[model samples]
Structures are given as C-alpha cells and as structure tokens.
Target: MMPVQVVGLGLDGAQGLSPVLQSLVASAKLLVGSDRHLAYFPDHPAERLSLSDFHSALAAIVRAAEAGVSPIVVLTSGDPLFFGFGRVLLSHLSPEQVAFHPQVSSMQLAFSRIKVPWQDARLVSVHGRSLEALTQALQQGAEKLAVLTDPTNSPGAIARLLTSLDLPWQYDLWVAESLGGEDERVQQWPLAAAQQTTFAPLNVVILLRQTQAPVLPTALPLLGIPDVYFASFADRPGLMTKREVRVLALGELALPADTIWDVGAGTGSVAIEMARLGPASQIYAIEKTAAGVALIEDNARRFATPQVRAIAGRAPEALEGLPDPDRVFIGGSGGQLQPILSVCRDRLRPGGRVVLALATLEHLAEVSAWSREQGWHQRCLQVQLARSTAIASLTRFTPLNPITLVTLTRSEPSPL
Candidate 1:
C-alpha cells in the first residue's frame, strides 16, 4: 500500500506549492481536503473527498487505500503537524502509513513577516482550545508569544485578554492575516485598535512585551502575581517566597489586617502581597540585608503598594520599632527563629496571628516545639508544589522545595 501523503498548503493556494508538490498532487488517485483546499487544484483528475469530520474522512481514506488507490493526498494548511491536522492523521494511521509534506506554519510566517526571531517565543494555539495556556504565559511575563487563532478566539479576543491581565509590563499586538497569499495583511496594532477593528478571518497574533511600564490594569490579580514580576536580590534570586508558598502564607494571614510585619522579608514578595491585599493597611517589611530592603521598595513602587514599608535590620531587633502587628509572616528566621517568635509572642495584639513559612524540618520542629511551649493555638499546612516546564522537547514538572506553614494565635488568657 502506498504511504498516504499529507501535503501542507499556504493561503496562496496552488501558487504556494513547489514543483515537486504540484506533481505529487497531480498524480493522486484520491484527494482529500476541506472544500476550500480542494478547490485549489481544478485540473487534477482525482477522486475528491471533502474533509469535514475526521472519523468519517478516515473511513473513506482507509476504504480507498485498501482498494489499491495510488498517491492518496490529504491537504492541510501550514505544517500539518504543528498545531494542525497532521497530528490527527498520525493518531489513527501508523507512522509508516503516512508521509507529511509541510509548508511554513502560520506561526512561522507570522514571525518572519514581523521580522523578529521566534526561536525563544512561546507559541500557543487557541484555534480550538482554551485560553488558559495563553493566560498563564502572559501572566508569567513571557517576552514573546505567537498565538494561533480561529474565528472564536480572534485577535479581538486576544486584545481583550491582554488588557485584562494587569501586568507590570506592557504588550503590543501584531496581527498577520492570510499569510503567503496575494491579499495578505500584516499590521502592528495597539490593543485598542486591535480590539475595535475587524481582521481577516485567517489571522495570527504576535504579542510582544513593551519595554516601558504598563498602563497598570485597573483590576490586577490581588493574589497569584507570578514571581517573575518581583525583582529579586542579585545574590539570592531563588530565595524569595514563591507565589504558591506566599499564597498559602497569605491565606493564614486573615484578610483586612490592620498592620502586617513581614519578618526576614527577602525581596519583599510576601510583604508586597500583603500590601496588595490591603492597600490602606500598614505593611512593614523587615529584612536583614540592605539589598533586600531596597528591593522591597523597588517592588513596592512597581506594584504601587505604598503601604509596604521596608525596614532594614534582622527580626527580633527590627520588631522593636514597628507598632504591634495584627498579622505577622516570618518567611526567613535568619537563625533566630525562637527569639523572633519570642518577640511576636510579646507584641502580637489581641486577636492577632503569626504565620511562619518554614523550609526545613528542623525549623518546623523548632516552630512546633515553640508553639507547644507558648501554649498558643496552632494550625499547620505543608505545601509541596511542582510547576511544568519545557525540557528539551517535552514538558516536565519541576518541583519547588517543600514548605510548611505554621499558624499560631495566642489563646485567651485564663480568668484571673
């Protein structure tokens, strides 16, 4: 049996085909493609089958092949396997049973037409899928993105999504339509223009991060700001509280805190979050390192959470100056866990709570023992998180360090 040939075509139709591909198409005994795809080759003398339903199309292709059809060609747009129909074909047909002839993908053509290197660009298809991946990518501050869109997930929808993310960085959208065709359209559009204007049905959008500060979104995510948005200490890039751990830590904080003391606040991740949650509340971020104190200020400005006040000095000592706190989060103990808790025990106001994110068993053990000794009300949550990342050609979940959050509140004093 002849290997079923899957030929990829651009919007330029027959004009886009190479001499070799034209001959292959001309020689087919059975041709299969969408209505528009089949219309490209009017002169061909092949049994034509419209490819509407994959299951039904596969049945016809199989029947024709078993009956000794020669040169069976399946037409698709762009590199058929790249977010295209080739993957579906290969799913049912054995690798040996199908041969894929690919054109430059829409993603590829969009990048080239825009004159940018896409080697590092994150590519997502909303053609027939959800926008979850696109949302995640933008929130992560991906420097470049190439999106494949259908009528439903059009450029306008993408423009709306971009504006709604409330990102620290700004992005500009580039829309490319009917690529490789005589009537191809390519234009860079401000998000507003892109949203209001109608575009060619066949289009791809390139989202590029602008260098200037973003016009801050009116509705930024109060929680779950990606760690990338926070500027970290040059020396300790990975030391800051991760979003997963920070979020769990924040939950224990209890909302609408009057005053928050973030002890050993490295890069001020937790502190900034506290400020975001309660913009009117007082937030004092105490960090031992001078660099950490400065970074806290920088991130505070970026997030526009002015309530975050960075105090330079270690805890137990730094706790001396700040007013009594309603909520306290100890992200780093700096080898003074017990003494720090000593201060928290002494100063935490009535109805106050302290939350500790401990990375080591020794610290958890120390915190566990300390809470026991203090006779304070205690609650604990152990968090283990893994994030999916690309490795070579496949995705793998990279595990973050395990974190244990211990929440403590002083029990009402015994009646005198």
Candidate 2:
C-alpha cells in the first residue's frame, strides 16, 4: 500500500503551509483533518473528512487507501510528531505507510513571539492528563514550561493551579490563540498578571522564567551558611538545624548521584544542601507541616537547587508511595520514628545509608538500639556550636542547642 503523508500547516495562514505539503494535499485523492485544517484547502475536490470523530476518520482513511488512493494527506497543526495525530495514525498504520511533513508548532510560535530561548524549557501536555504531573514538574524547579491547553484543562485552570501552589511570579507568559487564523491573538504578561486574566479556548501558554541579576562574589567560605539563610516559624523558633550541623549531617549521609529522601525534612535545609552537593542526585524533602514545606520551597529556590522536591505532609504517612531511596535522612520524625525508620530502611537499596538527627540523648539511644536490632552499622556524633557574642563591653560566646547525629548503612546486597 502507498504511504499516507501527515502534513503540518503553520498557523500563519495557507501560505505558511510548506510547498511540498501543499502539493501533497492538492494531489491527494482523499483528505482527513480537523475543521480548521480542511478550511485551509478550499480548492481540493478530495473526499474531505473531519477529524472531530477520530475513529471514523481513521477508518475512512484506511478504507480509501485500500481502494488504491495514491496519496492520502492528513492535515494537522504544527509539527505532526509533536503531540499531534501523527503518532496515533502511525501506530495504527505501518510507519512505512506514512510520511510526516513538519511545521512550526503553536508552542514554538508562542515562544518565538515572546523572544525566549526554549532549548532548556520543559514542554508538557496538559490535554487529558493528570495535573499531578504538572505539579511535580513545577515543584522540581521547572523554570520555563510550554503547556498545551485544552477545553477541560484551560489556561485559566492552569493559572489557578500555579497560584494555588503559591508559585512566585518568576515567569512571563505568552498565550497564543488560533495561530494562523484571522482571529489569531497573542497576549503577554507576567505570571501574576496572567493568572488573573482569561485566554481564548484554543491557545498555547509559553512561560519564560525570569532571570536574576548577577551579584558580586563574596570572600567568605562556601560550605557553612549563617542561620539567617532560612525562613523560620515562630512556634519552632530556632528548631531548624544550624548551618554547621547541616553540613556535618550531609557528609555523614554520603549522598550519591541517585535519589535521597530527607524524611521529616524541616525547612529543607538538609535536602537543599544535598542537592547542591550532589548535582546529579534528586533530593526529596518530605515535611509534614505546611509552614515547613513552604520554607523548604523558599530555601530551595534561594539556594538554586533545582532538583530538590519539597513534599508536604508528615513522615511515614506522607512517605507512602514514594520512590525507593539510595540515601535517607530523618531530621524531625515526631514520635513515629520507628515507623519512619522502618519504611525508609525497607525502601533503601543495598549499600544505602540513613542518617538520623535527634535533639535528646534519650532519642539517640533509642535510634542506636533500633539500628543494632536492624543489623545496620551505626555511628553517632554530638555537635555543640558556640557563637561569638558581645556581653556588656566585652566579647563572649553562647552555646546553642546540641544535636545528636546517628549514621546507619545497610550491609545487605542491593537488588537494583
């Protein structure tokens, strides 16, 4: 059987359609496409088919081809291979039976109209898919994103989703509607403004992440940061681990270029640091408190750890249905330490390490005993930090809360 060609007609107008593609459509014995696509070829006498009913249209294309139709032209928007009907058609018809003629996608035009480079941007389709995926992508520091909007998943809904997550206005959005049509329209605005505005039904949303101006280099050492780097809540008030303690805890975990779970992650200090140290690793900051979760997100952005995942909800309960970890750190497990430890230890691959930070000697003893019972090797450290302060007319030192660190490594062979 002769191959059917899937061609893209650029949104600019009929003239935007490639010459070769137009020729194919003109010579085709049968044409299958959307209502908009069919309107582009007014002079063709072929049996025009509407793609609104995809199953029937597909069957018609197959039947016409079997009847010796030399070339069946399938008209599509943008590049056929990019989230278009070409993939579905090719899956049913043999690849050898189809040819693809690509054109500039609405997403590409949207981005180009805004004059932003999209090489590093995350392109996602929100058409009839889970919004959770989009949430996860944004949470993982997706700077720029090209979202394909549908009737059910409109631009307004997407904007609402971002606003619900309290995402900052770090993006400039370009909404392109009915590209290539007489009613074509494009609107550009900051994310904050875009969230308040409504867009046309057929549109592509392009988000360009805002860039910060460069800062002069500082002379201070890089590893340990001062206490002020984090956003703290009044109730916990200094409950977050100190900068020095975080550095030591990160080292003890010996995180690898894999997945690390910061269970009971508070303010995501440890998780953010791990992401900074292990550039190739994914750090999951699992926190139970809403305030702590928000702090983790703020800290993650502040530290430029794009791969850190700030997860809301508590440990063990929140840790349900998470990916297995190569390293785990428990910072604030409440009283469900045993359950959290069990879940993390079970999820850790062989050779995986788990680090626990306890505030009291009693908790340290409990974890130590638990580690021995689990047949894991353990090491403990008591960290006491003293900061220089001015007392009256002289300089003095004050001791902060001491932290106990417990490190554990599983000796069992990995099944990865």
User: Where's the lowest-lDDT run of ten residues in candidate 1?
Assistant: 389-398
Q: What is candidate 1's lDDT per residue for 1-416, written digit by digit as tens? A: 35589999998888888999998998898899998999998877888999878679888887776666777999999999999878887777678878989998998888999899999999998888777788777756777999998887789888877665544456779999989887799999988887788888889999987644334456768797876577765434455788888888888888678998988888888888888888789999998888888888888998988889999897788788789999899888889999999998988989898889888889988988998898998788989988664322234555777988988989733322
TM-score of each: 0.67, 0.54
By TM-score, the best candidate is 1
* Deviation from native of the Cα of residue 344 in model 1, angstroms: 4.6
Best by lDDT: 1
The C-alpha stretches of model 2 lying farther than 4 A from their native spots are 167-170, 180-185, 190-196, 210-416
Taking the tens digit of each residue's C-alpha lDDT, what string does model 2 give over 121-232? 7889888775656655654447789888776566666665655543222345578888766788888765467656766777988765444312323632355555445555
